[model samples]
Structure formats: structure tokens, C-alpha cells
Target: MKILTLNFLTCARKACKATNAAFPLHPRDAELEIVETDLNPLFIRNILPRIEWDALREICVELGLPTLPDAAPEPAALFAEPIVPADTMQDADEGAEKQPTQLLQDLHRLLLETTIATGKLVCGNCGHEYAVKEGIANFLLPSHLV
Candidate 1:
């Protein structure tokens, strides 16, 4: 599953849902894979507000992925500043549109390209482990857990 999915997932157990620790499920023995995808800056910009910055950082630390910034970047930072110099005044329209930046590419790698091929996602609150295999996570709780 994508890291984006993991960031939003909490403990399956209803009891743990209300707890602070349950939101960022801890991955154990994760087999990570890189699945390349086209970067969608508009999509990223739209989804930025919904992403939990701290939880994403914590998950990255757990998976030994590259560290994210201390704080999530502002939406405006996703686009490169249009560099229309006064010297090269020709084709001003070409530089007028915003372009995706390195930060956006980095975010695309983390949120969309990275995947957990196999792992166990353990809840911080209840210690219930959700098995992940073949990039699919089993979130169905047994009757005992339900």
C-alpha cells in the first residue's frame, strides 16, 4: 500500500480509534518497493491540508525512509517561482504558468511511489498487528478484536 494510505490509517479496533497513538500504525519488517507514477501537483496541493505532517514523519522514521521536513511545506511552496527575467523578455507567457518543484517531486515519491510490499502494521494503542502481504493490508479484525 502507498505511504499515503498508511498515513491516514488508524487501528482497526474500535477501542483504539479514539486514542492519539493509533493513527500512525507502526510498520515492522517492511519490504518496501518503489512504484513510479506521474506526479500530480494539483492533486498534491489539494490533498496537502488533509495529510498529517507529524504522523507521516513518524512513519518515515519507522521505515527508515528519508527524513521529511520538520513541518509540512505550505501549498504555495509546491510550485516553482516563475523566472521571467527582464533581459529575456521574449515569450513571457511561457514563464507565466507555475511549474512543479523539487519538493513536489519528493512528495510524489513518498506519498505515491513508495509502497509496503510486505509488513505488519502494529497499532500503538492496542498492539494489534495488521498483516500486509503483496502490497495488500488485511485490516479485518477477528471476532475477538471486533
Candidate 2:
């Protein structure tokens, strides 16, 4: 499933449902595939405010991908010289345009291109296993869990 979907998901166990920080369920043994697509800077910018950086960082680490900073990127910081490529920053006039585009490219790769083809999402608190097969995550809980 798309990593973007994880942003909206949380642990299904009744007890864990209310604990927002621990969830979106953590993927384990994930087999990832990257399907490149055109970047959408606007969409990335729109969703930036809603992303949970820590959870995303954990998921990235689980998927054996590069981790985002320990602290979340402020919306404004995305356009800063550090994130914008050095070449882009060299041309001050083009830096503004390039920064957002670069940031969009990165976010697009993370949230859309990366796919989990096989794995299970384990609840951080409850230890529930949600199987993912052929890119589809089965989130159904056992009767006891329900």
C-alpha cells in the first residue's frame, strides 16, 4: 500500500485506537517497490502539514530507507538551502522554484513511489499482525481483538 495511506491509519485495537502517537501500525519484513511518477509539488505541500514525521521516520527505518530528521521539517524549511541542492541554491533567482520541486520529488518518492509488496504491519502496543500480500494490507482484526 502507499505510504501516504499510512498517514491516516492507526492501530485497530480498541485500547490502542485512542493512542495516536504509537500508531499507523508499523510494517515489518517489508518488501518494497518503487514506481516512479511525475512529482506533484502542490499535493506534497498540501499534505506536509498533516504528516506525522516521527511515525514516518520509523516506517522508513523499518523499510530500510533513509530516515528523515529527528525533528519534522517545518513547511518553510523545505525551501531552505540545506534541502535545496547546492547547484540550485547557487542561482539565487532559481532557488525558490527548485527547492519546492526538489522537496516534492523527495516526498513523491517516499509517499507514492515506494510500495510494500509483502509484509505485516505490527501494532506498536498490541502486537497485532496485519498481513500485507501483493501490495494489499489486510487490516482485519481477530474476533478477540474486535
Evaluated with lDDT, which candidate comes out highest? 1
lDDT of 1 by residue, 53-114 (tens): 99999899999998888999998899987777777668777767688888988998899999
C-alpha lDDT values of all predictions: 0.91, 0.79
Model 2: ten consecutive residues of lowest lDDT: 77-86
Q: What is the TM-score of each candidate against the true structure?
A: 0.90, 0.78
User: Which residue ranges in model 2 land beyond 4 Å of their true spot?
Assistant: 20-22, 77-99
Clash pairs detected, candidate 1: none
| Cα lDDT of model 2 by residue, 54-105, tens digit | 8889888887898787886667755544355665667766655634546557
